[model samples]
Target: MLDYLVFIGTGVYLIMQTLGGDKVRGLTIELVRFTLAYSFLWGAIEKFMQPDLFYHLLEEHSYLAMGMDWEFFVRAAGFVEFCCAWHIFSGRAAGYAGIGLMAFFVIAAVIPFGMIDFIGHFLFIIPLIAVLFTPRKVPLCRTACGTTLAFLVALALYLLVAYAAWYMLYFYLHLDLFH
Candidate 1:
């Protein structure tokens, strides 16, 4: 059920991002942006409001011992997440920001939680690659390192934006793969 929901969400987001026509794309982008931004913003607010929640989670998982002040890091992460969401909707630096955020998430998952959540984050690299490789602008010369870098960055962004799709594929669409 959750997987299905995430699939739907990812599908909607991709369609919205790739949709043509300025008016339609603008509206769709706005809608997607608002939703994405609000999600992270709310989460940031929540974490700020309830500082102990993260602390308790850390303790429960034995990730870190008691009395570590991670509130600043948590707040900064929330701000960055919110910014990444904003960038995606704006279609400006979104591609780069999205990819960077995904990488950050992957690192965070592996270093803190071990390999448990790593699988989930690792699967996001696929859609990201697709999005990155999709030609956005015409190139004067294809050999430019800048172009390749752009593609890589875009791939990263795609991974971040389409992460729900990965989750859906792993958790719901095809359970056997993960198993």
Candidate 2:
């Protein structure tokens, strides 16, 4: 329902922006960048503000071991997310930042299990597609195209592997919900 709408809306927006190449495209790009910044900044803040909650979230995630010391990783992840968020909001190299963050997210999606993992994968779609369809300040060349293709290929592979891992872990482990 909502997902379908998002898919269609993004697709149409990308096509129009990519082809039209106008002020509207620039605005769209800025919007995407700001959105990422807000999202990541909030996520980083939340992770530290509620350590207990995050720890509980990790426990439910299944892929991460129960006793693993997550203090440093959580803080580090928060900082990295904040940096990425700042880069995005500033509208400096948004495409490159989006691509880098999207790749990082694709990796993170495969790291955990359950619906959260799937959500992470689906979340990357918007940024990745944004990078692909947005008109860049610098004209894209053949080498850039090849690089994009390679990243997409890697993303797909990671997705397949993640799904399989989730399925296997879901059946083997009885994950308890906190709320």
Candidate 3:
């Protein structure tokens, strides 16, 4: 589900970027940022909520398996993901956030899932690279009140869209997402 969203989002971003216009470039950057941010946010929430899934993955799948508790590692990774998502979403040090996310994904792909994971996540690499190369601009919200409001609105939208997507996949399409 998340992979579909990121793939579609990256395609749209690439099309917009290829159009060759200033407004298109700006819009592409913003949209890519939103897509990446939402992806990371959803992943972080899922990891935190279902630590057992991560624990099992670490136990059975991961190559560079940690010696410490799996639950603790899951929580720590979730926290880091949340921080990167927040920074990217808020347009505060977004370039750095993009770099961080890219690094994390690269490491995760190599360490656990290998070439398959890297290929699966190739679409995401474009948007992360775009964000890293793009210049940082002022956030949509300037003032404190506006920033707070924007964050709330973004969170609400993220939840709504995520739920709708999940519902469509699980209920309408009869796909088992958690398996």
Measured by lDDT, the strongest candidate is 3
lDDT of model number 3: 0.69
- Model 2 / residue 86 / CA error / Å: 1.4
lDDT (C-alpha) at residue 8 in model 1: 42
Q: What is the lDDT ranking, best to worst?
A: 3, 2, 1
Model 1: how far is 145 from its true place, Å? 30
**Model 2: ten consecutive residues of lowest lDDT:** 1-10
Q: Which stretches of candidate 1 lie over 4 Å from their true place?
A: 1-6, 11-46, 60-68, 122-131, 134-179
Point out where model 2 deviates above 4 Å.
Answer: 1-23, 60-68, 91-98, 114-116, 132-179
Question: Global lDDT of each model?
Answer: 0.51, 0.56, 0.69
Please, what are the lDDT tens digits per residue for candidate 1 over residues 38-93?
A: 44444544454456787777666644433445776556655566555444433444
| Cα RMSD for candidates in order | 14.2, 14.4, 4.8
> Any idea what lDDT model 1 has?
0.51
Among residues 3 or more apart in sequence or in different chains, the pairs in candidate 2 whose N, CA or C atoms overlap within 3 Å are: none
Q: Write the per-residue lDDT of candidate 3 for residues 53-109, one digit (tens) a residue.
A: 877777675654456666777888876776677666676554485467656765567
